[model samples]
Target chain A: MNDLRTKLMEAARSHSPSDAVPIGFEKQVMAQVLALKSTRQPGLLRAPVDAWALWTRTFLRATWSGLGVVMILSLGSLAVPPSDGDDSDYQGLMVDSIAMPIDETGGEIL
Target chain B: MSLLPEPSAVPSDLELVHAVRSGETERFEELICRYQARLFVMARRYARREDEVEDIVQEILLKAYTRLETWRGDAPFEHWLMRLGTRICYDFLRQHQRSREITSTELSGDEVDWMECQALPDGRADGKADAARTLVARVLDRLSPASRLVITLLELEDKSVKEVAALTGWSVPVIKVRAFRARLEMKRLIERLDREKYL
Candidate 1:
């Protein structure tokens, strides 16, 4: 069994080394290398976004979204009339105050 | 006293490495041209397809170029590049193993006959050599990537366990274990082939 194993291994090892490099393989490699070099951004300037950067970006995005929601809510409140039934008196008072004419002549004692 | 080396003398790999590190990027092409054939041959041992072989060679060259600074002048540049190449091959094998299953088809009668002929002492000729190489490749395809690599390095390339360890970043004991497993796997594969051929 050992001899057969050795013989098999010898047969396997006897397989000739393949030196048949495809034509233009070096040129292809050089082209790829050059392309990679050209496409590669400088490490310092274009390093991959780290955890800190990603966190900051996410935080900023969330903050901006929250601000947008707040702005929309504020604008929505301003556009819609107050729905509280108890504020009817205050609303009437506001209308009356706006309707009151401004005195154009010298102020008279009230 | 003459301060300069002879003009006719070839620059050593270390000298070229220094030139490359010193901003002589074009000189890298010289290194590439010098080592491309060797790297291709090494890649071929691990890669069955031509495209894969090219990819391995290209990757090795790109890595060696980008990491030139890491190469201390302790060993010959060729040896260093070879180590890098071997590691890349191992990685490729591992990746391939993960992505695919290894299945062995039974050898046909003609193929078995060819294998028998090649097994003879004097049957190694031009066409037969190619066939034998293919047969060996097919047999190797049935092994796990690690086993295949171990057998290829130990049996085919005649590398020692220590050498494989250094090349693969595996410990000596690990290499020994893998080699043993690889040999057993190979023996089983051969036995199966022998049965198919005779029965």
Candidate 2:
């Protein structure tokens, strides 16, 4: 019984193409792989070209820009004149003296 | 990305994947060369057109390489590839079966009869093992994707049920039941073949 089946299997496998790789299959796949390799990301997350470097440089540029603004504000404040316009309402009252009549003296309290 | 690492230094698929992740492209190719035949055979059995088989094999290889990061390395890489190819083929077959029209008679008569009885043993005259394998491959080809895979992994590849489940993303109980049904189906198919003149 077993002999019968074995013969059949041998016949089947003999005709079967077990390892018939197509001509240039490796080259074709490798070509695609080369293209694939070019598309690979540089990190775990695919960062765009100059993403991090550009961001850091922009940040530093903005920081200096902010410092310039601060310096300009300080210099502008220093260049302004001090307060010169004073109120004169209380100036005349500062020296005004009130005299009580001398008690029964000094020309009869005139 | 890192350059492809040395093959001799990599001990496992996981290590190879890590190396690829680190930017070693050759490691990926190493993987492809090693398993391409297996995947191609499995895919060919499913695809009707030779072109379709080649496309599916390339597609699977590309997908496998691209998604190697997703591989958990918990199961054998070959089993994982088998699972991928089987699923793809199943989807393809199911789609074609729905859309295509074929005469029942043609389906049965187009192929020549398989003379399973004539196969002789080279050294071991007891042909039990080899005969059984031929019978099994035929039966396997007829089975549903889920059912066929259980036997392919557990019987042919010597994977445990747990390993099969892990590779297939199926539960152990599901794998076991499918395996049982697949075995029954194989027996029935063999008996039917026996009735035909091929045996």
Per-candidate DockQ vs. reference = 0.16, 0.05
Which lDDT values do the candidates have, in the order given? 0.74, 0.61
Please state the i-RMS of candidate 2.
6.2
TM-score of model 1, chain A? 0.36
Candidate 2 matches the true fold with a TM-score of: 0.49
Candidate 2 wrongly placed segments (more than 4 Å)? A1-20, A34-110, B1-16, B24-27, B44-50, B72-86, B89-93, B96-142, B154-159, B187-199
Candidate 2 lDDT tens digits, B1-199? 6554455654567667777766777667777777777776766555546787788777777767666666666777777777777667666655544312222232222122233323334333343444444444454556666655566566555679887776678888888899888767655554556555343
Predictions in order: chain A TM-score:
0.36, 0.35
Cα lDDT of model 2 overall? 0.61
Task: Report the error of model 1 at residue B86, Å.
Answer: 0.5
Would you list the clashing residue pairs of candidate 1?
A: none
What is candidate 1's DockQ? 0.16
lDDT tens digits by residue: candidate 1, B1-199: 7533343468878778777666566677878888888888788888878888888988998888777777877888988999999889888887876422233345544556665664567754344444555667776776888888888888888888888897888899998898888888777776666665655
Candidate 2 has a DockQ of 0.05
Residue B180, candidate 1: alpha-carbon lDDT: 88
